[model samples]
Target chain A: MTCTAKKCGIHFQPPSIILIYEDQNQEKTRKRIMPIRNFSKFSDCSRAAEQLKNNPRHKAYLESVSLRQLQKLYSLLKGHLKGQSLAQSLEQVQREEAIDPEEDMNKLDDKELAKRKSIMDELFEKNRKKKDDPDFVYNVEVVFPQDEQVESCGWDAESDEGF
Target chain B: MAAAGGDARAELDVDVDVDAGPGQEKYDAEENVKIICLGDSAVGKSKLMERFLLDGYRPQQLSTFALTLYKHAASVDGKRVLVDFWDTAGQERFQSMHPSYYHKAHACIMVFDVQRKVTYKNLSNWYKELREFRPEIPCIVVANKIDADMKMTQKSFNFARKFNLPFYFVSAADGTNVVKLFSDAIKLAVAYKQNSGDFMDEVMRELENFDLQQKGEDFSDKEESCPEEKPPST
Candidate 1:
């Protein structure tokens, strides 16, 4: 399968579900193939897919690699359940498009670029002054903490050299 | 044996379709088992999973940063089992894994490169992380990249012995012990599911919570933010 990226055009095998089973009476193992349904058909991908395809920013970053991964994950999730729940879970991880700093470069018009530059300059000026203000403090941490039920484990010890 | 069957019956109160015909029905043995792979970057953990699942298909290393779930079916002792191989990004950044990734995992395969002494040294840290969340789940220690010139056979054996976890010397590139490792994992998972009384309950609870999260009804503040931002080092 060719990647969805128009520029990349890399040929890659799309992920699919293949079930290998054994006949109870027979000794040889057999296989059954299952079609991987399109991700867009699922209810959850509707909004995310639209955003992924229509937005040039997203398309640029999503790339063929990410698109393939997304499809593979979606197929695995959808294969297990008939409900729309898997779609919802996927939408959770579908991140918003980043605000590109070079967005103005795409427009060939000079006036538009100048206008964007002015806005950017104003925001940059505000950012610089805000950091120097004595009243402003970056207090994202909590003073008091309670013990929470969280589990983390590791091996007993480490060896730099193989024994 | 009857008691074991009875226990299994109670635990499997899943809403599996009952009306599907005999051959058409998804067999009880055909249940989905989630198996997680943990190892240092480039220990061939992903390759091992890909080789086992695709069975002779070698995929180009995409070097995924986040967790990627690969689904495949295996016939173990006349039972068809759907295995979900969760290939984690790497072990150096254990902080990336959400606690839920370990929830209800039927089995684990912790891998290390035979040539890289550093990867083998980090195995204990991986074990500790896994045991913290899943204290009782069966884990296997695999010495991967056996095709490499540097062989640590005895050391790998000793490490496996220390944890009492089954060990396999595998070469994912050449397809050595890859099949055995996966089949053994599936068997261990099936046995673990049969024996663990609350295993299914935990899985069900996690599944429900997953559905709730999908619906935006999850009120828990502890949800992982910025999940999988750091990709595994190539």
Candidate 2:
């Protein structure tokens, strides 16, 4: 359908009529269903792309990705540490020192911390192969500008321009 | 124009006074019931809602360019219920819906064009998508475009029956069972809300038991704390 704008009477075609199932005489029905093209074209794709790119969900998804990575790292580190609290662990180390002064608790703690860090690094390295996997689908949905918010984006309301 | 109206309502933030006349108090309060429409493209999901809301069908008019909201006040079970029908233009080509679209949805209407077997085949996909968000919400299956020659067969009825959902064969063109379908949808939504309140009570009882168990308290203590679930005298 042609936009009602007097000066810019550009024609915009709606998405093609999709008929997955129909009667046996499909050719006649197809001809009847198709809309006639009047005007040549209108360029709106670049602007639509820009709008899609700058959607808040895009930014939120990016932020969520990093946050999720950090969370996974935190969990892995916790697992490696055997659920020990710093204070309780320090107390245990002091008690161990009392039993045997020659064995350095600080050295043991540092060694343990390094071991956990290495384990986390190795896990990250192992999963890095799946990073580029085509099957790995991200849980993200495209968020359009709200109807109220879309008004400020130069979208002509009546004709549904810049869709 | 719809966007402007929606924006104006958003800005007001107060209950819209829909009562224009004296006896309109029967339809007073703004109890919002959100109903989402889902289906394959060209299945008349938009047309069905448009017909229901406007009481007229515009064949050439594509009512949904974006998420369109239709607000109608219905006197459901003696209560004024402002039902918000959200028409998500079935195809997710340019923009996929944010999770917020299903947020607080009270009911769903899954439409499929009876003429098109593919649309009928995609019913489960739509139902699954709806359940992912609003699991407990009541869903009604609608076989739209029944006016078309190649209508849905007995198998369609069985499909809806399998899910134990209310199903209706509707025609947006001739307005066959359209009004009753929407009215029934509202009634079902009201009933769902009522049942959900009771469902919450059941949840609270379970939560209280869990809390008591966590605290190492006796089961008898629930009788003292959860007075709401107290047995009645026979």
Candidate 3:
């Protein structure tokens, strides 16, 4: 019952997520058309992706597909509904996922902050080495490079104003 | 690849097109005409669509999106036209539909339960929202559940007359006027898409003109009048 997902794409007209997969048991390549209902340009891509992946009908086939990939597909569909071109949607997704260390996330709105946090969570999950990984090590240590001087912050400076 | 072909046709803005070759006349639709159904919850919106598209009436409730899409293939004057009938899927209970539901829509079928006077009164609000997004498309006011009271059909409804839109008294349970209502809607949608001076259509036409010029095909000669199909009497 092993299924290998080969490709995933979006259908804009009726708004469906099309998945091409190989069913090893049947030895056949099949396409699964999951109709995206109730989705609008303002829909949250991550929530939509989670729903599609957890759907009883599609859950089995989508088990091999990553949630991040599904979210990207939904994001592309959302962009198209908002009258954006394919290239524009891809660039937008890339920009959202790319984190800037200098950016102050505390200034972001709740929804924007949640989006950034989810992006960080996905990135951390991807880079994490699990116990089952070939490169897994019981104990690993690395030396810190302190070549650059640290900048002092106002909060870290002791002052008579602090209680 | 099939999905890509559908998307390409959507871009071309050719909603109804005749298939190639003589005598090979099974019309295959190249583009889709989106028709949205708006009404209050429990007003038989889904039932009417179910009755019209009797076969393959698989209604997927993607509650997250708050809409259900009913896909039906119909032929208008020998040209195959794929129609997507959008149902509210109870989104109306929240007092509004997502603006995307009206985005690029060709026509609208606003329904109300004949048994409920409140449903009838709410037509104005639904029509207002619909016009805010789509100002020029053809909209039909439907009085559904006519089977409950046939006398309702005899009673005049001023909403449709006031708006100058076509009206239909349909019964999803008995299938009265169901087929005619849907078929006529499809025709109106196709007509709107062909005649309306939408901005997207204008851009698509310019693109098509460039391709036609390179291929040496006369685009002007392809303009054919819409067939005047008589609406079957209910």
Candidate 4:
């Protein structure tokens, strides 16, 4: 499929399409589903319940938060809570509270929420590197201008051409 | 231009001139042109960047974890220039604080809100600080936010007369003389990098000395408690 510019005469190349098959058709092996004990229940559900008593069901919440955040939340109630900025402590407490089982059943805003996944990914990477600043920074997204980006505008070959 | 018009906004995320360069081209060969904008809070540095980058320069809600960089590739005299831009905040809190992002900038733009002449007066401190950090880098002194009240339309070349930096007065809100200033800046950056230009450096040098008194710096034997009242710029 071709991607047309929303309004202008320009057209952009569509991203490459990937093909997937339900069965490993004559190739790769079949994957099996295995369950580890619901370890998340102890940390996410229980702690969230203990903190706020209200957690709306979220299909993506458990999958979204960083592992460190989960561990921190779990540990917040583990011993005498570790040293944390008031903001950090409150954020952890809220995440636990947000994961409670008997909360409301509203839907989630997926697009806005995906922003956190990247933040979580950055945090996990920073923790692994053991850096001084573990927060996700915008520099992580200093993207190289893509070919599609080049198609946008500037340097008219005619009137402004000494190029 | 899509900028001065409508319906073209959503459609164009970028504006590239492929036919101009036309083919598998090498990355711009010219040395990168780094432009840094520093000024007091809300003096419109970011707005200027936005006006130059995107037509709608919204007020930044949060500090960029670091400075912002935008790349504009252009070819002049068969040389390609990739302009790397840095836009900074002018809050006093950030004044002495090291810019984690200001390492090797090639040129600097010290902006002031034209409406607030105090901002205009203090352009030197910003210039001094940055020059102390990168002496050889060329600079452009810009008076911004010209769209607001201008008690009178007096042509105050006061900012320009004082310094050697190329001085420009622009209203980013209305897009008055913005592109010309930007293109001129890039041209100056190019000339400086190649050591082929005189006007830019010459202008900036005069600009530096012109506003010394206005900046509350005493150039006299004893620090002058009050500056000699020079008439406004014409």
Q: What is the TM-score of each candidate against the true structure?
A: 0.43, 0.41, 0.45, 0.39
Instruction: List residue ranges in candidate 3 displaced over 4 A.
Output: A1-163, B1-30, B198-234
Ranking under TM-score, best-scoring first?
Answer: 3, 1, 2, 4
Tell me each candidate's i-RMS in Å.
24.0, 28.7, 32.8, 22.0
DockQ of each: 0.01, 0.01, 0.01, 0.02
Model 4: per-residue Cα lDDT over B1-234, one tens digit each: 222223233322334431121111111123456666777555666656666655223333325343444556556578767675556443333454243333345567777765444455455557666654455667777766545533213344344334456766565555555666677777766776677333323343344456676788866432222223211111
lDDT of 3 by residue, B151-208 (tens): 6665666667567898887766656677788888899988887787655445545765
| CAPRI tier for the interface of model 1 | incorrect
**C-alpha positional error of residue B203 in candidate 1 after TM-score superposition, expressed in Å:** 11
Positional deviation of residue B86's Cα in model 1 after best superposition, in angstroms:
0.3
Where model 4 places Cα greater than 4 Å from the true spot, the runs are A1-163, B1-29, B55-65, B89-92, B97-102, B150-153, B196-234
- List of clashing residue pairs for candidate 1: A153-B128, A153-B129, A154-B128, A154-B129, A155-B124, A155-B125, A155-B128
Error of 3 at B222 (Å): 21
The superposed Cα distance between candidate 1 and the true structure at residue A13, in angstroms, equals 44
lDDT by residue (tens digit), candidate 1, B43-147: 667767766655433223224334566666677788777666667643235433555466567889988766555566667767876765566778998877655
Q: Which regions of candidate 2 fall more than 4 Å away from where they truly are? A: A1-163, B1-30, B55-65, B94-96, B150-156, B197-234
Kindly state the fnat score of candidate 2: 0.00
Better of 2 and 3 by TM-score: 3
Grade the docking of candidate 3: incorrect
